[model samples]
Target: MASAAEQLAANMNFGSFQKASELHKRIWFTILAMVVYRLGTYIPIPGINSAAFAQAFGGQSQGILGMFNMFSGGAVERMAIFALNVMPYISASIIVQLMGTVYPPWEKLRKEGGEAGRKTLNQYTRYLTVLLALFQSGSIAMGLQASPGLVDNPGLFFVISTIVALTGGTMFLMWLGEQITSRGVGNGVSLIIFAGIVAGLPRGVWQMFEMTRTGALSAFAMFAIMGIAVAVIFAIVFVERSQRRLLVQYPKRQVGNRMFGGDTSFLPLKINTAGVIPPIFASSLLLLPATVMGFLANANLPAWAQWVPGMVGQLQHGQPAFMVAYGLLIVFFCFFYTSIVFNPDDTAENLRKYGGFLPGIRPGKRTAEYLDYVLTRLTVIGAAYITLVCLLPEALIGFYKAPFYLGGTSILIVVTVTMDTVAQIQSHLLAHQYEGLIKKSKLRGGGRGR
Candidate 1:
């Protein structure tokens, strides 16, 4: 069955896609949603000077905010409503997922709860998103007021307006993501980030060229950077697709007059099971506080409060503290998120229930233990790969003035999302083709039932 499926997939062509009406609609809807998102990024927040805002963001563009600006498709640089991006939702998701590991109620909901339970959890995520948005946006407002010529008028009204606008923008993005997942292609939230990262590619290239033109980067160094980027891209694609497969053997069974014989299958575990989530979560955890501080550096803070922002500023991108925290968090989340998504205990239980067992392993607890052992090793390697990819560029950036968007996280997101989206499209096309064949078979049957 697996071989035949692979053969069928290999046979896919443009003709099949052209015949896929449902897929066409989905693709168009996704494009339209992404376009809307891009347009909104250009829409400046009210009572803000676009030029000054851009200038201020540029001044600090080498910090975490610049990394975030790349993720928001320059929205943060513009101080647009979407400057907050969909991060609040992503942060909320991380919180809820982490809670599931410790909180009994959440554990129950995630493990045994049906679709209804998932919906309930989703509702909780949205609530948390709003709360996070409120705090972050308010801090951002304060920061904006502190920057000279950035805000037209700075006061109570500006703070109130900024908070409302930023929060509303985040909520809208969360809703838009859901709509895209349901009505368009899947992985809506990831795709939003993907679009943002991709949108900055041309600009990053231009910035690289400028560095060479200004003699800060030699022509040899520029070509070397391009070469390194291509190599990194290849590495990312290869590792992301690699998986560890465990073979499961199903025992023969007798059902009535027929012998429901044994079968074998493989359970594939992806190397980077957490996808781009670890970096997003880690970046959010570190950047949220730093962002508040960055904004408040010029704010009317007392002397004690004044030094806090200054201290935190040292933890910005490429700093030792930032690097250590980022790497550790990525490793932690790699294991944590992988465990959340793939539970060995549950997998063992399901296998037992289905009369399946892994070769050379017991059917229950032992099987679970074995799976855990294998996964832990895989997770370590995956985490190391991710960390190296993300942090290796930081050192280079400090010296050569490279763009943060060129880091490993962006490459992972772009590659994984593109692969997943394409797979979904192909699945839809395959389903449509099967339906057509079935209809033709039914018509040729001359009213005789199978």
Candidate 2:
């Protein structure tokens, strides 16, 4: 027999959706938030010489700046106020999460302090975001000043204004994402990034067609690219939906004159517990060095430091070294993030407290060990899968010069966010149906009493 929620989902249709007023409100709010983000990408910052910056950016568009521009929804390309986007916030989050594991006080707070502790850590992440934004934006400002004609006025005031504008833009985006999370559907930050990538997708497709028409790209190659993309999408859906279920059984117990407890449940562990995070983190870290080097390229450097730019160049897009580094970082973050999000020890203790045990497994320390063992194996498979998905785009970009919008990371973000949003909508519809059923049952009971 299907579960009640599943049955409700099966019965759901357009009529059910029309009756979900709250769901409509959330969807509208999310759309409004995304629209605001898109508009911000077109609002350029002060002191940028538009023509000069465009010419300069065109030359570096195939490099790290291009990737950043894609993530920012062309905000960087436009020299917009939101050029920094929410990258600083993401970097800050990674740092804070890393700290929570190593720092004893933070570890205690994460494990024992509960909601208050989480709030404190979020505050810390915000503070760190500010610091990082200041640094990154300041570096960008100075880099622009070093490039002649890039800035309208090359002076201290221009630097201060640019820093303030970019940093303020990043902070505003962070807050906007939070609002979307609470008041709208889907993850605020991921949706923001998804909106950016999707906004550029039509242009990317048009450019590809233009290439094919101009004979720059062969028709066969174009078809192959499309086929690969479709295959990758199917692969992502399958892997993301896969999970391992562990059977958990509860002992029979007597209460008063009746038997109270004797039931079975499952502990479902996803194959990819840290979904879409490892690839995002790995990309961010790899882009950092290139960002720094790109900025410093405008500066007068000694002969010894000239090699830095050459080395950074080797790490771009499809280079072997870049691929190796990207794969390693993805694997590392896969395990690292998994450990942070799911604690086997805590899970085991909770199960033991509730008198539940896995079949043929010890209840306490041994259960924790078993869970950790299973998760580690699952993570290894997950890491390999993520690495393969992410690397395919790098290969295309490197060899075929495919558009960044078609990259695997962008596709993963788009697909994952869409799936999550749809799931939430389904859940809301199910709840609404359940409420209706309850009300109808109460009405029948009241009628009988009358």
- Which one wins on TM-score? 2
Candidate with maximal lDDT: 2
| Lowest lDDT 10-residue stretch of candidate 1 | 392-401
Per-residue accuracy of model 1 over 258-341 as CA lDDT, tens digit each: 888598999998888888788888887877787787766656787667686666667767788788888999999999999988
Worst 10 residues of 2 by lDDT: 292-301
Clash pairs for candidate 1? 143-295
What would the TM-scores of all predictions be? 0.95, 0.96
Computed on alpha carbons, the lDDT of every model, listed in order, comes to: 0.85, 0.88
Q: Which stretches of model 1 miss by more than 4 angstroms?
A: 255-258, 447-450
Report the Cα lDDT for residue 220, model 2: 85
Evaluated at residue 204, the lDDT of candidate 1 is 86
Candidate 1 lDDT at 116 equals 77
